[model samples]
Target: MADRITLTGLRVFGRHGVFEHEKRDGQEFIVDITAFLDLTPAATSDDLTKTLHYGELAELAAGIVAGEPYDLIESVAGKIADEVFAKDARLTEIEVTVHKPSAPIPLTFDDVAVTVHRVR
Candidate 1:
């Protein structure tokens, strides 16, 4: 679908990394979600029920990011996509991006992120 709902820069704390300290200390993760679906029904009717509730979407993503401990940001991205797809049947597709800014690396970098795209 051409119509889409996008939620960006969702920050949540997560204990996800390869190292032990990462799991123990935890860190912040930023998530971005784009859900593609037909918006004609909601737009014409002006009904909230006909469209995806972004607040609920944000909560869903936040819970996922804060709930699970993963070894990779890629896994986090995938999980977010899976959960979003499961939560909304109206969605034709979804793209999820998980950002890990405090990743343990020797080199200097602005950010590290992984994106996962899923089609229903």
Candidate 2:
């Protein structure tokens, strides 16, 4: 069985949007991350090194979101997945979900989201 660790609803201010106004002002984004890792060693030994530190992952993800200005959420999510893979080679798989709060649309809606998964 795959012991998965998850970080959800990580909020950050990022400049990712289709329009200039949207990009200039920026908006709040929510990110959800899932990492497939074996936690047996950590559970048995009770060592932080044996398991993933979700807070560190969250900070890393936030740095990516705030650092890159992609026009599409798909691109953002893809980059996030790539970043995660680059950081942790041990992760069997990684999933990223990005929520765009200020998406341009005709009708009223909550937000739009994009999810991407990568495996090593």
- Which candidate tops lDDT? 1
Candidate 1, overall lDDT?
A: 0.94
Question: If scored against the real structure, what TM-score would every candidate get?
Answer: 0.97, 0.94
Where does candidate 1 clash, by residue pair? none
- Tell me the tens digit of each residue's lDDT in model 2 across 4-108: 999999999999888998789898999999999888988999999888888889989999889879889899899888988887777889999999866778889
* TM-score, candidate number 2: 0.94
User: What shift in Å separates residue 113 of candidate 2 from its native position after superposition?
Assistant: 0.5
Q: What is the clash tally of candidate 2?
A: 0
Candidate 2 Cα RMSD (Å) = 1.1
lDDT of 2: 0.88
Off by over 4 Å in 2: none
CA RMSD of all predictions:
0.7, 1.1
Clashes of each: 0, 0
